[model samples]
Target chain A: MKENYDIVIIGGGPAGLAAAVSAYDNGAKNILILEREPRLGGILNQCIHNGFGLTRFKESLSGPEYAYRFIKEVEARDIDVLLNTTVLSLEDNKTITAINSEYGVFSITPKAVILSMGCRERSRGALNIPGSRPAGIYSAGTAQKYVNIKGYLPGKRVVILGSGDIGLIMARRMTLEGAKVLAVCEIMPYSSGLRRNIEQCLNDFNIPLYLNHTITKIEGTSRVTGVVVSKVDENKQPIEGTEMHFDCDTVLFSVGLIPENELTKGAGIEQSRNTRGAVVYQNRETMIDGIFACGNVLQVHDLVDFVSEESEIAGACAANYVLNGRQEHNPISCINGDNISYVLPQKIDKNIPGNVKLFFRVRNTFKHCKIVVESNGVVLQEKKKLICVPGEMETVILSSDVIAKAEGDIVVRLEC
Target chain B: MNKQLTCIECPMGCLIEVEVENGAVKSVKGNTCLRGKMYAENEVICPLRVVTSTVKTVSGKMVSVKTDKPVRKSEIFEVMKKINSLTLDRNVVIGDVILANIDRDANLVATQNYND
Candidate 1:
């Protein structure tokens, strides 16, 4: 195996796998995927639920299923996949220093790098719930890994806070494993999970979903004793005299997901505060010509299918960059105006072929909505959707014909 | 029967009410689809369900597995008993038969991602 390759992908999850395969298909022969875990699949291994692969497969499949499709593609393509390896540091010169027993602290200087480190689950400490820092408090992702992937129940009685997908899935998973879920408390009036998840994971399980409520404090010592939950006002401040205690052994927090951008940030990439991700080109390339990002590391995707879908673009871009050098000019900026969380591909080169696709998410869920892409108040294209949720991503197509006409900055906005 | 049921045929989530007379559906209402009306009729007599959850595995993921045929509303526990007795050996693929002949006809199958 060569130390230096055309591409160096940071994570070997679905994103890296798809990217590697796509890179191979798109002309880059020497591509490498470095993952920290012993296995390639990242969070998908623990997801274990359906609702993934709807877009990519056109049929519903579980998380692992969706991941295996990409994994199989990479395997079939004979892509280099390195497990139990972590990229220690990345430099401005596209040099990656990675360590593994097989390749101990090797320096690989690739022409380009794709960052797909994925996101990390926010823990209890980040929530600042005033209480004793004790055991039996785990992030929903940790507990999920324990039960779904590791085959060990986290607890017999659990109270999960935050209704993100992992928390909702865990609520049902814990129930089926013979544990009594006290309740799922959400600080907001609505769950952050997909509406389908709320219906399938909680409503079907007969679990009580307390909206506009939260766990004010955790009461535990060595292990876990109980928890103090309370109702809150619109500002999420606990209502006085509304604190209630539930005798549960575990408290799981699924607060939110933070994209792991240490390397991207360290590399001096321009990121968006709204998306908490890097502002990239249509090719998923950051302002740094040779660098790219995809998957949860780019933005927390509701389904793994979209991750696989996006990785292809990143991989193809990296491969194209390695093969014929990236085109540098004719960049058209992408803007996210009101109601839109953020837009990927912050810019696009007019020289590119075909229509460009921009993926984004909304701040709130809407039953019926329109996503409009415009240039200087001139609506370029508009898409109407019957149902749109914040958990699910929305994409708009900007045709090459449209790009040919883009005289000014392209702005993407969502309307209810 | 003194219970109300919702049709899960689709995302419509049709709320349907049913009344049973002489162990059979006597009246059904609030169903938006023909399938929902039929579901209301059958639910009063022999309620069918689509059970989804993870099953124990020897060395694979604790991924979702669905019964080829939904268990009888009253036989969910019995079906689970049978499902518990069986084990998924290593190298089980998706759609692999983990517990065949579940109810003389149905098969308990792996629905999650796996490789044989």
Candidate 2:
């Protein structure tokens, strides 16, 4: 109904909602959230699981609950919400072209923009699973969405090919509703999901989890009926003699998640193959002026609360941009070093908030290591932790005071 | 004291700053509408959450289920008490309402993909 204004947020997930809310709180009043789904809620609609909202709200809430909290916040604010609206592209300094079934197509030039389109699942095609093209094969996330949100059962007896979080969760999910989960097979020796999930969701249920294994063959005609699982060696090569076959109607693949960056890429933002995402500043701002990204669109996080936190930062910054028009703050280079997989803030600014949370992931599992944050190779700050696992994301907070003193680039590295 | 409130209604997360003056909400600030205000007030007091997770089944599968409606956030662990006590009957379909009464009020619905 309205023409153009302050902020235009893409995707109606938790990140988009948080960005819109935080932007308004910081004084960017004119805001709009465009969601492609029939309604808001995004992936949380299908998540239907707990372990959410622990950080944002002291209570453990489900995905829907976490999303609803922000949804409720967005409704309270005067931010315009446009659901069932798909953003076609972004061009020419945050100019947006989007369409909804009800409203044809429209273009808007927002002063500031936030992108929270989330991510996508690695389908069976992405995984060279070396099997027949079958009807029963389904991505664990897709199966989850249909089963949990859309209220459709995907299979009867299932063999999950990957031990990712969604697959692991689905293993337990299918079992609860009276389906027999034969086994959860993982290619890598180590599981990609959180350890607690393995112990509680799979082990407690008396389900077998086969590590260092891969699904060799899928057997079925018009429907799925059987699958062959083979053991893998140290290098993850499938061993010949270790092949085991099972009779099952469904095969769920829980391989991996990929950031949805078609819009980001089309925007011509600088991207890194390592992260598969556009390089952004400390404030979650993309390389382009007045454009920002957060949540899975920026980085994949194990917990939605971190997504909420990052989106809040993105939201506040977008609001600041609307109110103050292009912040003139000193920048500090951010780098990943040592065992550190990657540092979130590719760069930093002088006027960061009092509690600035820097998110990152580790290269591999490590125990009792020191995470040192350095400036110009000098140890500025370091924290020792008992455990750091690649499955779980790590966050370090440096007070605004410490950030103000930084002159050159900042580096995060892991040391013994 | 009226705590500034925002609706946690849907994923929209309507931000409303509510003013609570004497242990009671005085006025809500920054919400789009009344739905958001009521949502924020409810969030301040009895925030409800749904529980969807895996439960052990005799068939060696993990069945996912959720409380039919949202339950009090404080009652999540308690509600799981009922879920822990539950065992699926043979041939249960997806989207079947597993337990309609959780702690006497919460409704638990079975997920669609239960090994099928």
Candidate 2 residue lDDT tens string, A188-273: 87888876467546864688999988898889878888999999888788899999999999999898888999999998988766
Query: Alpha-carbon error at B4 in model 2, in Å?
Result: 45
Which residue pairs collide in model 1, if any? none
TM-score of 2: 0.80
User: How many angstroms is residue A196 displaced in model 2 relative to the true structure, after the best TM-score fit?
Assistant: 2.8
Residue range with the least summed lDDT across 10 consecutive positions in model 1 chain A? A54-63
Per-prediction fnat: 0.22, 0.11
Local distance difference test values of all predictions, in order: 0.79, 0.79
Which 10 residues in a row give candidate 2 chain B its minimum summed lDDT? B4-13
**lDDT (C-alpha) at residue A108 in model 2:** 92
lDDT of 1 by residue, B1-116 (tens): 65677665443456788988788777888888687797678776776654455677666545556666655655655665675565566656777777776765778777665544
Predicted structure with the largest TM-score when compared to the true one: 1
Give the Cα RMSD of candidate 2. 12.3
- Worst-scoring 10-residue span by lDDT in model 2 chain A: A195-204
